[model samples]
Target: RKYGGAIETVLAHLQESEERLKNIETFEERKEELKKILAQQRENYLISAREIHDKRTKAARRFEKEVETNLKAVALEKARFEVRIDAPNAADLQSGNNRRLTAKGFNQIEFYFSANVGESPKPLARVASGGEASRLMLILKTTAKAGDAEKSVVFDEIDVGIGGRVAEAVGLKLKELARTQQVLCVTHQAQIASLADQHFLVEKETVGKKTRVSARDLNEKEKVEEIARMLTGAQITETARKHAKEMLGAAK
Candidate 1:
């Protein structure tokens, strides 16, 4: 009985194999049809890609203008920011080979910058100093609209290589930006730190061959004292405390 059942199963398998061979016989005709369909789809993709490139070009121009305008606010008045979009020109795109395209498409966008007048713009990464990059990033991320309530922005050492009025300007810029989003800044500048809504003291200590870094919040008095400490280092003179108080009062 088992041998009989096995023969019947083998017959069912042979029937399925014959049906699959029939499909293989017609596969060449279907394959050619699919190739033509895919070619049409490829052309459609190129058309859509061109539209995306055009939109990005227009948006890049607007973004460049906006960045240059805000550059003046952070003392980069003479600096020029440019957005360079390198893509297959209309002729190359029309070639329809699609071999030159990357996963991100045919466009490669880059930022160029000149930090001073009479100098030609170079790539932003190669040319911009830390402070310049920081301010540029801040301006780029800043929105003209208010209330990005769910977003938190973090700034680390944005005040580098700047001091006096420029530092104050940067601090004010952070304050203004904080109105829209939560701004967390790490800075040695008392001007900037004093503008913060809350203050934290971060300290590192070593014990029994283990080292740890910890951060703790400061109260109103501790915040004032901490700002004063930033102003005068570990010494914390009375004059610096008074100045720190004045800064806090001004913030209010």
Candidate 2:
């Protein structure tokens, strides 16, 4: 009986060891499977991020190059353009969550300019004078639309800083752009506004004590009156109205 009890105890010990080994093997197999899944997910995320960055980089480079080329074609050869991209730290790029390109992304892109020859290009915000800023904005916007597949482009206050021949050049540029994109400009300048496919007058009127905004789509006769008001400001004289008519006819 003593020998039989000793044999049973040894068999119990061996069975416990086998169970423990099996448990350890099962845990190691699960760990390996999890590692493989995680690696595949990481790879997929990286591939998607790279694809997006490539597309955006391509578009940005194309637009910037085209604008620079067009500026040189015109006499505005002093203009320069750039796109700034922020990159991740090496440690973060290697170990952390996958990074992706966004609309704004981790980057800040700004248009830069230097109007005068031999001057370094500065940020658009640093530009001085309303006229210079307006012109710069127009040039940037116009050049951006140069390769646009759109059918219409609208300019609000495009003539803010321009007058005389410069204003005429703006009008001509608008007309040229209109060849591809229908150009709509809101202007105080009779010269600039006259180039529109359609012109409407915006005005403020006081009814009782409340001032309200109103817009009028002017006919040929009313367009003359509206242009006269813009030229003379509030008091529309006969001479100013006649001048508005002449300006309209000249614009044609």
Give per-model TM-scores: 0.77, 0.57
Candidate 2, 1-252: lDDT as tens digits: 433468788788779889998988799888999999988876676667657667767887887787666555334456676654445555765775445334444333556667677777777678534555555545566776553546655566567645766676777767667766666677888767766666788889899999999887889998888878878898999999898888888867
Could you tell me the lDDT of residue 71 within candidate 2?
52
- Give the C-alpha miss distance for residue 196 in model 1, angstroms: 1.2
- Backbone clash count, each prediction separately: 0, 0
- All candidates' lDDT scores? 0.84, 0.68
The sequence of per-residue lDDT tens digits that candidate 1 reaches over residues 1-252 is 433468888788789889999889989998999999988987777777778889999988898898888888777888899989987777776676576676566788888999899999999889988778888878877733444879987878688777777778888888888888898888898988888888889899999899999999999999889989988899989999999999998987
Model 2 ranges off by over 4 Å: 1-34, 44-62, 68-79, 99-141, 146-155, 172-184, 205-210, 225-252
Candidate 1, 96: how far from true, in Å?
A: 5.4
Displacement of the residue 233 alpha carbon in candidate 2, Å: 7.4
Worst 10 residues of 2 by lDDT: 99-108
Clashing pairs in 1: none
Model 1, global lDDT: 0.84
lDDT against true structure, model 2? 0.68
